[model samples]
Target: MKAVVLERFGGPEELRPADVARPEPGPGQVRVAVRAAGVNPFDGKVRSGAMEAVFPTPLPAILGLEVAGVVDAVGADVTGVAVGDPVFGFADTGSYAEHALATTVARKPEGLSWEHAVTLPVAGETADRVLGLLDVRPGETLLVHGAAGAVGSIAVQVAVAAGVRVIGTAGPGNQEHVAALGATPTTYGEGLVERVRALAPEGVDAVFDVAGKGALPDSITLRGGTDRIVTIADNTAHELGVVFAAGPQQRSAERLAELADLAAQGTLRTTVAATFPLVEAAEAHRLSDSGHARGKVVLTV
Candidate 1:
């Protein structure tokens, strides 16, 4: 199978198109003929070795985690998924390839495209997890930082659907876009706290910080506690007593199915910021690393 292999992690340029042995499914896994792969910030972190201390990948690792494709093989113990099934999920062996392996997956409804389905596993799962972690209930106000980006935007819609009022922070250009997602949007830099306060006079019930642009302190002040504040971007979460919601404690196949159903029903949505050919995985990673992409970046295989 052809894949964008990282001979050694360093930069986006390290991802090179090459032929590699196709991966076979292990126990409880399935092999997929990958149609598209989602490029995320964590993929860049893995490629650049920034997450080496926590997520160490060996040399010549494939550099993607989420994929949408047709399943061609299923391993022992696997159930509810089989050959010829159109599916999307997280891949343990990486997804930037012609074939990928997944231990858990959900059926891709006909309404969802490959590019869109591929974006859900990581970004959608994380958004749902943080909202669950906060136990954000209906009739409460929530503040979402980076609400215009992939994960943040999904978080906004999920919260809104649950009847939680959302106040999202984004660039001026994205304010209206966030508003369309059911949040009162505000610009992200200075005066963010004041802006949020102005929007939610009763104060926010919880804060979801996905941008990590030094907003943790203000979020703490607004929420009046670190218990209700969670972040995926800020490493200083521990120092500030905030929960670093990085692990997959709240993730599950059932949740992925629910998200896909929402997307299929036009309830949850994500824009394709850019799409690159399989050979141009490097460019996709560069766009993701730029931190300016307005939506999910994907690689068509």
Candidate 2:
């Protein structure tokens, strides 16, 4: 199998394409013939050793977390899924390759391309968890920061579908795009607080910050407290009395299945901003580091 391996944590340059042994599924797992793997900000964070304390990976390891592909084989105890079934899921490790192993695989939504399916496992799952924490309801206003990014985009759609009025922050160029996702786009810049205030008048009911650009504390204060504020980007937000709701189940199979169904129904959009061949995983990471991707960056294997 061809995979991009990290010899050591540093920059995108550290990712190298090489021929490695294909991973086989162990008991309670299945092997996926990876079609596409989603590149996430966490990929960069882990590669650069920035998130070492939280998600330490062994050196020379493959580094993708989410993949969409076909099941080639299932290990003992795995049932309800069989060989040749198209599936998507979050793997423990090693998804940046031609084949990876997964313990919890869910059926991919019919009609979705592999590129689109790969985007759901991570970003969609995070959005689902945040929405659950906030308990966003119909007619209430929800505010999301980094609204044009992967997780924010899904959050917008999910919140809107649940009948919540949503206001999101993004660059001026993406205002219409975010608005189309059921959010009122507000500009995030020098005075984001003032900008959000101007748009929401009565104040927002919830805030989900993924930017970790120092906007969360103020965003929550504007919404009137720690209870309505939840952040995924900054794990330190936990100590600040805000919700830090990320877990392995943050990318659970059940949640990805639901997200895929929404996509099949045309109610969800897992926009693929761009794609690179599996060998160009380094380049994909570079694009992701730019911090302005409209949606996910995928590596097609």
Candidate 3:
């Protein structure tokens, strides 16, 4: 099988197209003929060795975090899906290839394109997990920092569906787009804290910061509670009384399935800002590293 393999950790250029042996699924896993793979900042971090202190990848690895594809075979103990089922799940690597192995998989949401399905496993699930941590309730106000990116976009839609009043921060270019997702869009800038305070005079019920800059405290100051603020980008932010949501303890197959259902029903959808063929995985990473992706970026296999 042809895959984008990285023998060493570095930039997107480290991802090289090579013919590698196809991997067979072990027990409790399944083989998928990947149709699309989602490129995320997580993938970029792993590639650049920035996450080496935390999550280190085996050398000569393929890099991708989630995928949309069809099942070609199921391993022993796999029963939720069968061969030929269209499924989507989180794999994190090897998804940039034509085939992938998944320990857990769920059906793609009905009425969703494969490109959109690829965006959900990681970003969607992360948003769901963080929102769950915040325990947002109907009529409560929720604010999401970095509202225009993959996780934030889905977070806004999900919060709105749960009946929470949503306010999200984005650059001026994305202000109108986030607003269309049922959130009052605020621009993140010099007076960000003041802007948020002005909007939610009573303070927001919860604040989700995907930007990861230890910025949760600013939002928390407005909300007046550390418990109400969560950050997915910074793992160490938890020490500051902020919550982190993507480790083994937080990611779950059940939560990912729920987010998929929401996407299928049109209650949630991701904006794919750009797409590249699998062969162009390097270019995809370069674009994502810009930190200005309007939505999820996908690699078609």
Candidate 4:
């Protein structure tokens, strides 16, 4: 199998294309013939050794977290999914390869292309999880920072469809994009507090800080405490008494399926900023690391 292996962790330049042995599924797992792999910020964090303390991977490992592909082999005890199924899920063996291993695979909906399907596992899962954590209710205004990024974009739509008034933060150019997803768009920066205040005059009920770009202090000020503020990007959330929610336990195949169904029904949609061939994994990481891509970066096999 051809894979983008991280010989060492430091920079996107560390990722290199190489011929590695194809992974075989163990018990309760299945091997996927990867069609497209999702590139996440977490993948870059892992690649840079920033998350080594939390998600330690052995050196010379493949570095993607989610994939959309066809099931080529099923391990023992796997029932509902079978070989030849087009599936998308978290890739247990890392997904930056021609073939990867997955434990909780869900059938990819015909309505989604492989690139879009790959985004559901990570972006959708995170959005669903954070919304549950925030307990966002209909009629209440929820503010999301970085509202135009992959996970943030999904969160915006999910909150809106649930009947919540959503205010999302993005760049000036993405204001319309965020608004199109049913959120009142505000630019994130120096005057974010006033901007958000201008939109939600009644006050924000909760703050979901997906961007983590020093929005915590303002969020605390708006909500009167860290009780209603949660962050995924800033490691200093604990210092500010805010909740930092992450890790794989938050995602599941069921959540991915729900997101897929939403996309199939034209309710939830994923933006593909760009797609790179498997060999250009390095370039893909470069874009992801820049943190400026407006949508999910995908790698096609």
lDDT of each: 0.88, 0.85, 0.83, 0.88
Work out the TM-score per prediction: 0.95, 0.94, 0.91, 0.97
**lDDT score, candidate 2:** 0.85
Query: For candidate 3, which ten residues in a row score worst on lDDT?
Result: 243-252
> What is the Cα root-mean-square deviation between model 3 and the actual structure?
2.2
Which pairs, if any, clash in model 1? none
Can you write out model 4's per-residue Cα lDDT over 95-176, one digit (the tens) per residue? 9999999898789999889998887777777877888899999999999998888889988988998999999989889999
Clashing pairs in 4: none
The Cα error of candidate 4 at residue 242, in Å, is 0.9
**lDDT (10s digit) by residue, model 2, range 1-301:** 7889999989999999889887778898999999999999888888999888877787888988888899998889998889999999887657899999998768987788899988888887788778888888999998898889988899898889889999898887889899889889988767877888888889888898877777766876687778788887776686677877655365467767878888888878778889999989899999998878888999998
State candidate 2's TM-score: 0.94
How would you order the candidates by TM-score, starting with the best? 4, 1, 2, 3
RMSD in angstroms, candidate 1? Answer: 1.4
Q: Across residues 1-301, which tens digit of lDDT does each residue of candidate 1 receive?
A: 8999999878889999899999888899999999999998888888998888887888878888888999999999999998999999888788999999998789999999999888788887898789988999999999999988888888898899899999998888887899899999899878877888898989999999988888999999898878799999887899999998776445578888888888888888877889999999989988988877777999999
Q: Work out how many backbone clashes candidate 3 has.
A: 2
Best by TM-score: 4
